[model samples]
Target: MDGPPATPPAPKAPTLGNALHRFANPGRFMRLSGALLPWLAAAGLALSVTGLAWGLVFAPRDWQQGDTVRIMFIHVPAAWMAMGGYVGLAVASFIGLVWRHPLADIAAREIAPVGAVFTAICLITGSLWGKPMWGTWWVWDARLTSVLVLFFLYVGHIALSNAFDDPERAARPAAILALIGAVNLPIIKFSVDWWNTLHQPASVTRLGAPGIHVDILQPLLVTGLGFLFVFAALALLRTRTGILERRARALMAARAAEPAATPSAVAV
Candidate 1:
């Protein structure tokens, strides 16, 4: 018989990192995400509608740009989401490269298209706004050019991600490209201050108070947040769909590979 009772070790404390890793299990992720999907969708839609309506209908027009400033609501949000989305891509790529996580790789692949769309929207609206303000539809300014490069990076990642039949092989190169392309993000952010450009300098983000008027900035912030929420919801939905499709393919292939059931020797 033991003379002294031994003390039991304390259970490990829960951590944010550890909790997040639980989603690495595809079955666990599917169930949780399915339960949460409707809430995300509803919240994104509601915020987007409210923000867009407020920005378009209720916000005051700028004296300098007049009604043309309305484009900022749309253009600014898209621009922010484009960069924010790229940052997310780079993060996902980093995770994929280091951990070889299937979810991270799938997330990186799915994020590319959404980021590209936002980049395209940014360029289009910027051009539309520029035509009236700058008297041109296009300009090779530092900010604009950097954003263009960002767009190209997104496209290249998408192409590379799909180039290989083996997703694992494809993931490495795509992840590398995403990491490399992350260099362009800072350039896009600082291009206005770094060099002369038709594009305006920071209005909503600055050293002290935002340069933008509050009447305009409030709706802009709301719309930007809405855009961010929608982008997140969309990316998660795509990732979920990708996971389901992959599982379906694996099931089909496994069934095909099964030995044909021996036709019952038909005893006449």
Candidate 2:
């Protein structure tokens, strides 16, 4: 009698948790990031320069806003990165809290200051654009207010993360704050629709069609992508630095703990 064919081994399911776990090793992250860093940095710089030149010099002026509209090249991208950075921060924090990923805490810590700078750029540029268009340097508009709050949240996270005497103890509370602060992201996105404000409603991101003309929209998209690459490069660099710093600190602690050698033993 022919025996029944043996069953094949079941394939494992791929999930977010599993993927995160696979990349949790700090050494693996360092090697991968190191290999990719130069390429990412070069791409980022090239794109940024190309996009800025195209937008500032070549793109047609807006019918209504004129050259001041050119500010969007930097302002829009900074705003996008500011929000995107926080999302990354929150995700890193979540991974750190749940899986105890070795690099997650380092990622969260490094992302905060960079995100804060982007947020500040967004606000400053928004104000610069506003003064001419809105006839005011500032307003308590919903979108503006929420973005300001987001900036403060970034600042708070940075301060809190560095406040503790022990690096190991610093991450948890900041992570919790990050998770809680995520509520504001959606608010910032929807504020124009949710409330009447001085800020314009979505032109590029709306459903049906992007209200922006292709001439302007193309450059905007390019610049925005460049900013994204810049963010990635910066984050990877900072995370690598953080990893090296931790290793150095561990080495110092190990050396400090060793017993002092006797003078007689040294002479012998």
Cα lDDT, all candidates: 0.90, 0.93
Off by over 4 Å in 1: 1-20, 264-268
RMSD of each: 3.0, 3.9
- Per-residue CA lDDT of candidate 1, range 29-96, in tens? 78877888788778878888888888889999999999899999999999999999999999999988
The TM-scores of all predictions, comma-separated, are: 0.90, 0.93
